[model samples]
Target chain A: MHIVDGALSNEVVIAGSVLAAGGIALGLRKLDIEKIPAAGMLSATFFVASLIHVPIGPSSVHLILNGLAGLMLGWAAFPALFVGLLLQAVFFGFGGLTVLGVNTLNIALPAVLVFYICRQGVAARSAITSAVWGGIGGTLSIVLTTLLVGASLALSGDEFIPAAKLVFVTHIPVMIIEGLLTGFAVYLARKVKPELFAELTVSAEATS
Target chain B: MGHIVTSGPQVLVNAQVSGGNRLLDKLDPRTRIITACVYAVLIVSFKSLVVLSCGLALSLAAMQVTNTPVKATLRRMLAMDGFILFTLALLPFTMPGTPIFSLFGYGFSIEGLMKAIDIALKANAIILMLMVLVGTLEPVTIGHALHRLRTPQVLVHLLMFTVRYISVLHQEYLRLRAAMKVRSFQLSNSLHTYKSVGYLVGMMLVRSLDRSERILAAMKCRGFTGTIPLLDTMQFTKRDKVFALMVLFFALLLIVMEWMIDTTY
Candidate 1:
């Protein structure tokens, strides 16, 4: 998911940067003054929450929750997740600057897609139904993210195709865990704060 | 891959390393940020092993100059390499070239091996240089430098707010995890585990949302505007100029080495 500096071709990197900038701009447009606190809080929360180590088998995996993030932040997921990746790269040395845009796009695009597909379902009348939808969205985003990461690699070179396939295969278990956790999280949010999925105050309405 | 927190626990907090009054710590944060970016791209573009090794050496020198901790940096770099090794190991098998060896009757190509080594070198050089140069700056200072570099205002604001609140939210997370532990909660691969962790995260998000609302009200009450004005006293002095020139010369030297090696090839 976090492609390091030289792994990606220049074409992929440049295209990713252009598209990610557009997504961030569009997200910023939808974000008004009032929504800053909510967006920023979620950004910081996910940054911290990513440290959670969920045990799987002999090993454990941390949470991506990009689907949950997309469900929570919609288009703003672009900037929020981008900011998270930036911090991780700069502070933690996880991803490097050259690949930041490609990494951001691979992780965040799936998030925006989830927001579009599951926003209404997560706001369903019954908490159970909403959780189910959230679970599906969560799983789907992970799937999409892996696909994008695979695509980025596969498109780079023929030799990378096997590595791309390996990445997706190893993460099937992760996709399930993400789905279950996101579903339950959405259930809790629905039960406790039903307004969690309410539409953000787009700039037009906030000004009016 | 997306779920891996390869850096382990130390990087989540205490991001600021104690640089002992080093030159990197004193140079304008912008200089470091720009140089890191340029050097990263330059290193990535290089195909010569000679240039790559020199680039790595330069980065190591930078690390020494800045006095970055060896153990901490090694741990983080190794974490990244863990995943990378898995990916790059396959290259020798998938790529076709002169057969050097066989594993499971599959030919391992020398060309692919060289490519893998080249990538590993390039990735490590860029990351080491980046961590030593830009990662030393305070997160807030990085945000302000981005603002000064004419990044979009709203994005800068978002970064500032997020950086400001990471510590606060991290503490809240610790408290919730402690409360869960007090209740004898343990993690296992089961539905109950996912459900509880989900609840933990869900509750944290809900509370943080509520907290943000109160925070907004507090700020509004203080006549705070929507945007935080960039208020920093970062000055680019003669020292920064000297450092920036050295960086330029080093970059040019890398390009020259790359070209000189290419002709010999």
Candidate 2:
């Protein structure tokens, strides 16, 4: 769902940048000293994790792991994803700098949304429940991202509607793969170090 | 449409190509970054093919000035613009307008071809500008530029650390994958495959968190403060300002031409 540069209308691009700026600000405020290094490591982890490609058909896709990042980091996923996208745009030319805001918004907003929707469930007592929720989070992130990418393109002009639909259609396989991968990942984390998720639960309970 | 197909080794190879072109490398990172952002907007907003072509020509010149090798740059363009190419191929068949030509009894629209070409040109111009601008700056330079621009401190630090440790973690990932492959593990669309890859990523996460702890300790030992002070600062030179102004002037000219075309038509 990386919306390449010049793919979006100026209106969508400008609006995305504004919203992404707000997200970054909120994420920065939430980024405490303790979470800083963890955020950094997670950002790096995301950077590397995304490079692992899995074959689907003639073309291959890679793990976005934004769902896991949001499940783990909450709002901090904004800045973390922003950095990863920025690096990808700058270093690898995966996306363009012009559309970085749209790309970040498309990818990271779903992450934040998943955190709100599934973080609690992902911290559930039973590993099975946590894994299931994590899977849903992963799948939902891709679904939302593709929708946003499609919406961005479609809103650009009616001419792009077919292409936008094509994007969503192609992403169905990615959704399934990412869902299963995230389920297993959440399951493994629960088994190995339950505290990793326990922290979020405790923090949420404290805040509430 | 282009998801990440490149591998860890490719990422490692890309890490070595940090910014340092004679022309672009000399400009302040801030100037280059701002100009690129402005150029992106200008190029994307352009509706006229003629104006977009001018933008493309200027971007190409900038790429040449930055010493970006043409072949590698074109490959990057292909990777990034693959979806646009697909759209260009499909536009004529689906887009409604006067038919320009027909293939296999399918009529292609003149307006559709123009729109497709417009999108392609804009995409090319923006990518070329970015390849010369952002691509010619080191990661640290970008981080520092962000800092100097008074971006959020936490975000800048996050970007800096991510840039620093990505290569390290990538190497770790390669080793782990190598270990898995040695055991004859293959990536197939199966639950078993997903589970195993999940374990691999999970293990990497665990290691990364542990390393982050150690890294924080190491930094604290060195009297690390919350903010990293810039040891090497970039100063905006007169020449840099002149270059930025010249670019902006040309960009304005393109925008004006686009506006004129819109008004005249």
Candidate 3:
């Protein structure tokens, strides 16, 4: 889901940069002293999560887990993912610098959205119900991300419309995989560490 | 798509032209980062094939000047070309334009082909430039450069800590995964597999939080403040200015040449 440099038009790129700047500002404003270490650790976790490849068919796909990150981190997911993407860009050249703003928006905006939509259910007491909400949130985040990716491309030119649609189509399997993975993740968190969700909720309420 | 069991070392490998001309390396990382950004914006914005080609040439020339490995650069470009190739394959069929040719009752347009090539060239130009500028710099140097550039202090710190702990957390994750595997954990299409992987991620988070608490305590014990002072102070000297000016001149030349070509043609 990483949009490489030079893929977007200058106008779209600039627009994305502006929106991303706003998101970063809001994210930073919400990040208090106590949340700083958690932010770093979550960023590191997100970074390392990419190395955890899940086999699908003959190939494997690295976990994005943006949805889960959102559910856990809320607005802070912006900076957490930005750091991960920045390192990935610098270290592996997975994405380029010019497209950094757009890429960050594409990945993290959906995260914040999912956070708003599913954080409550994730914090709910019933483990199975929370897991289902987590699954939906995970799938929805990927779907939304793919749409944003497509919209970014499609908005650039009519020629990219096909490719933009293809981005969504290709990610269907990823959506399913991530959904299931996230569902189980929420289930486990609910079982073993209910306090994790509680901490996130408390921080979210404090910031809001 | 082979199994990447050792991703830690894999991420550690850089696209540098090993032990090359020290000229590019000597330039301040800030200079390199700025130049790379300029190169990307210039190439991405240019519309003409002539200008785009010139940008590509300039990027390639920079790579040669910096002694960046051609094989490694090509490999990275090829890796990203998957999506570019997909678009290239689809454009002619989907783009609305006069037919350049017809194959199996489908129209292939010359305009679409040119657009695809233009996009490809622009992407390659940026990738090569990044390979020359960023891939060569040390991660810490880049982080310091970002800090010097006055990026948000929080972001800079987050990036630094993430870079420092990636390998440690990665090792922890591997050990945990290995532990699970030793217990006959095989990832399959079953709900059981998903639940187990979810547990794995959950456990990792728990451990990461615990570790962060310990780390915070240790830092506080050392009289840590909100902002840790950077150790290496950077100064932009004559050499840095000279390199920056050279980059500026090259960029202006490309822009003028493109404008001239556009006006003349």
Q: What's the lDDT for all of these models?
A: 0.84, 0.81, 0.80
User: Candidate 3, TM-score vs. the true structure?
Assistant: 0.93
Output the better candidate (2/3) by DockQ: 3
Clashing pairs in 1: none
- Candidate 3, residue B68: lDDT: 69
Q: Model 1 residue B195 lDDT?
A: 97
For each of the candidates, the C-alpha root-mean-square deviation to the true structure, in angstroms, is 2.5, 2.6, 2.6
Docking class of 1: medium
| Tens digits of per-residue lDDT for model 3, B173-253 | 888989988999997767677678778887888788888888888878888777878767677779999988888898899
Task: Report the C-alpha lDDT of model 2 over A1-208, residue by residue, as the tens digit.
Answer: 6676666778888899899989988888777766688889899998889878877767678889888888887888889999998877665667777778888899899999999999889989999999999999999999998998989889877888988898889889999989888988889888888887878757644543
TM-score of 2: 0.92
- TM-scores, all models, native as reference: 0.95, 0.92, 0.93
User: Chain A TM-scores, all candidates?
Assistant: 0.95, 0.96, 0.97
Segments in model 2 whose C-alpha atoms lie over 4 Å from true places? A204-208, B1-19, B101-107, B259-264
lDDT of 1: 0.84
lDDT of 1 at B44: 87
Question: What is model 2's native contact fraction?
Answer: 0.59
Q: Which stretches of candidate 1 lie over 4 Å from their true place?
A: A199-208, B1-20
* Candidate 1 per-residue C-alpha lDDT over A1-208 given as tens digits, one digit per residue, 9 for 90 to 100: 6788888888988998899999998888767777788888899888887878899899888889999998888888899999999988877778778888888899999999998798778878788999999999999999999999999998888899999999999899999999999999989987898766654323322432
